[model samples]
Target: MQSAIETARKQLPKIRIELVDCYTGSAAQALIALTAARAVKLGDNLNQIIPKVNKVIPEAEITLVLDTLKYLERGGRAPKIGAWATSLLKIKPVVTNRMGHAHFLGMARSRTQGIERMIRTMRGKIGLNRVSAIIIHSELETEAKELEHRLRSEFNCNETYVTEISAVVAVHLGPGAIGIAFLPS
Candidate 1:
């Protein structure tokens, strides 16, 4: 991004271009972008928008539950033995992105359990604060909606969205992956 910004600057020296790293991917990244967009729509200039976006970076959190670990193993993100064991045990792997890295939270025997774990983690982080959230899934819209409903009832929601994971993200997470990205206000 910096390289591209530099190249563009060479041609349009007076124009301003900046990149903000959300340090997370998927719905978390989208939430940051939405915050910036909302600021812009409210007539904030580049300077003001940048600060608002920066403030949201640390506040944003993402948690995901994968139906299987085979995709991670295939992508070289996990060990083959671990994926094999998860499959053999029918465990759903729960993970969260923190400081730009995916961290394993725990394992669940079912999707319901995984979703419950996600909500519990969010509650621990957010308490009673009002939250803005995005629920993302890979070929699992029904599950995503259910998660969204749960979130709305469990927290004071400022806004909520449901979306399918992008193909690039889906490639790594694989099908049947569901997750949430949230920011507490």
Candidate 2:
């Protein structure tokens, strides 16, 4: 991604191109890009768009519930012993992206509990603003649909997207993973 940005800068030297790193997951990163697109469509220049994008960065939120941690262990993000322990106990981890990395938020004995926790956190942080959300899942369309329905009925969202996790992300999240990414509108 950095290399792509560098190439774009070299190709358009006169136009100021700044790279802002959110250090978050793909969903949050995608939200920042979508925000920039909206700004540009509204005829905002770099100066105007940068701050809007910045505002969304800190407010960006993602809550992930993974059914298994094998991928995380394989990806070297989690210890093998810990992954085995969680699996043995049937503990589901609720992770939130912070500064480009996954941070453990809490644990649930069941997937339903994990999803509930995620929604509560999102509602608390979003306050009264209308939001836009993306539902990402790795072989968990049913769970993602439940999450999407909740987001639409319980929150003020102008747009809600549901997409499968990319292969790169799927490698870390494994199958039966579900998450929500949201930003204020």
Give the winner by TM-score. Answer: 1
Candidate 1 residue 55 C-alpha distance from true site, Å: 1.3
Q: List the residue pairs that clash in candidate 1.
A: none
Task: Extract clashing residue pairs from model 2.
Answer: 23-99, 23-100, 24-100
40-154: candidate 1 lDDT, tens digit per residue = 9999999999999999899899999999998989999988997998889999999999759889999999988999999999999989999999999999998899889889998
C-alpha lDDT score of every prediction, in listed order: 0.91, 0.87
For candidate 1, the TM-score is: 0.94
lDDT of 2 by residue, 126-151 (tens): 86779989999988888788889889
TM-score each candidate. 0.94, 0.92
